[model samples]
Target: MIVSGMSGSGKSVALNTLEDLGFYCVDNLPADLLPEFVRRVMRGEDRPEKLAVGLDVRSGGDLGVIPDVLSEVGGLGLDPKLLFFDAEDDVLLRRYADTRRRHPLSHLGLALADAIALERQALKPLRQIADVVLDTSALNVHKLRRLVITEFGLGEASTLSLLFESFAYRRGVPPDADFVFDARCLPNPHWDARLRPLSGRDKDVSDYLEAQPDVVQFAGEIAQFLDTWLPRLQSDTRSYVTVAFGCTGGRHRSVYLAERLARHARERGWAEVAVHHRELD
Candidate 1:
């Protein structure tokens, strides 16, 4: 695993999470040395089964040559997964100010903001080739760790980690979603006076939705679609796949479908199914 990102964008935290997961962790290795290091690990009998390497702007000109080096690593029969961490410039600036650490480029007489921009530009090639791009603007260390574990934890040895998140359409779909199903077409439980105060998890709301033929059919078709195609995705070497269900309010229809889908996926032998009710939270 290769983890590279903007400076102060949680690269260290991500590497630490991988370390906790039993990966052989290396930080700030020069791009030129990556293939040699992985070659050694591949040849070693006592090395950890998984490896996590952290790279950042400090590598300077070496960053530009990473793509070729990574290609060479792949040539050696290692499926190197690259994960890039990204955050908004404002958030990065705030983090630096809170920590009172000087930017790595401060010696070049560049302001912090300029240095951040330069770092992003330098890292663009790596980001474009990343297998997974995690936006850390809204995540703290703990949440980021959970996300890392959720995507790359033990269950990933066989199947993809499945996540179902319910969100309101007005709030926008999650950027990480692989498939988005709109539950707004189903009957609106919010319209009922009795169910207005209840969420999809409530028995009353579930019953109301369960009574609707269209709702049942919609959910069934979704499950069937995933049943047929998820294996295909897993075969593609994806570590994680997130399917988001969205409704107008996200409290009723979307939440109901997300929970139902998660149950169905788990029943179908998906070992790592997770559900998130965004509006409920």
Candidate 2:
């Protein structure tokens, strides 16, 4: 696999995850050297079955040659899949500010935003040919790592992975969510002093929410909708789907719905159900 992406878009994290999954990983290799490197690996007496290479604007050489190099590698009996990671411009800008890292193109006398724009334009061809283009604007490092593992390291490549996430509407809906459900209409556990400090994972909170008729009906309807549509989505060859639930505080209601839906998905024999509470995790 070839990993290429904008800087600060989690290429390092993806490479680390791939390494943990037993891939021999190399980072920032020049695009021009890829073909020769593959040839050397093929000639080695003990070649690794899995390999991952990272490339980006930092990789010196003509980026335009990448496509031909990939084709050349394929001709040598190696199937290379390109994975491009991206984020919204604002997200990338914020990431750069948070990390206090210089952009690779900053030395060329370009401002941070200009450097990012330049990198994006330079990487356009590679993105166009990418087998998968992941927008990481809404994903934390953990979520991105989980996504990589689900898509690549899972034993069965064909099985679809489902992620159920809960967030506060105040923080905004997750940009990557396939479906977003508002849970603000449900009972507010925050009003009850006893359950105020507890999250939806707590027995008291769960029992409280489960006791409400409106909550039960809402959950049931969401479950039925998923049951009716998820298989059709899977049949369409989607590798992953994210379902998000949002409420006012993101503590009780949203988390409970996410957890409940994950359990429901698992009970229905979906092998890859993961639950994440944004506020909690």
Candidate 3:
């Protein structure tokens, strides 16, 4: 695994989490050295079963070379995954203030905000090619740790992991979603006085939406589409796919469909199904 991201966006936390999960972790590894490092490991008699190397702006090399290096590692018969971590500019600035740690590019005499912008621009290639781009703007250390462990720790490396997330359309779509389905057209439990305070996870809300013909048909079609295409995606070597459901308020229809699809995916024999309700999490 190659971990790279904006500074102060929890690369250390992610590396630490991977370490705890038995990954032989290396931090600040230069990009040019990556292929050689992988080669040495592959030749070792007692190589670690899992390895995670950290690379970022601090690593002091051309970030653009990472993709070619990744391809070279793949040519060596190892499937390499790049995970890029990121956060909002304000969040990163606040973190630097709270921690009083210098930004990696601080030596260039740029202001903190400018350094962040420059770093974001410099890391654009890595982010675009990343198998997963984790946005930690709203995540704390503990939440980030749990997310890493849940997504990476317990799954077979060869199997594709599915993430079903529910989010409010009003808050904008999740950036990491590979597929986003709008659930706003379905029957909403929010209008019912008795179910107003209840979320989609509640039996009352589920029963209300499940009774609607539109909801049932919508869900079935989405499931059918996924059933037809998900296996093909897995066969193409995708490590993770996030399917997001969005509604006016995340508490009702969106959550219902995310939960329903997650169950459906599991029933189809996909072992790594995880459900995350963004509004409720």
Error of 3 at 175 (Å): 26
Q: Pick the candidate with the highest TM-score.
A: 2
- Model 3 vs. true fold: TM: 0.55
Mind giving the per-residue lDDT tens digits that candidate 3 earns over 97-156? Answer: 855688999999999999999999999999999999899999855457657766665535
Q: lDDT: which candidate is best? A: 2
Query: Which stretches of model 1 miss by more than 4 angstroms?
Result: 155-281
Please identify which of the two predictions, 1 or 3, would achieve the higher TM-score against the true structure.
3
Query: Candidate 2, which ten residues in sequence have the lowest lDDT sum?
Result: 150-159
Alpha-carbon error at 172 in model 1, in Å? 31
Query: Lowest summed lDDT over 10 consecutive residues: which window, candidate 3?
Result: 149-158
Q: Each prediction's Cα lDDT score?
A: 0.85, 0.89, 0.88
In angstroms, the error of model 1 at 242 is 25
lDDT of 1: 0.85
Clashing pairs in 2: none
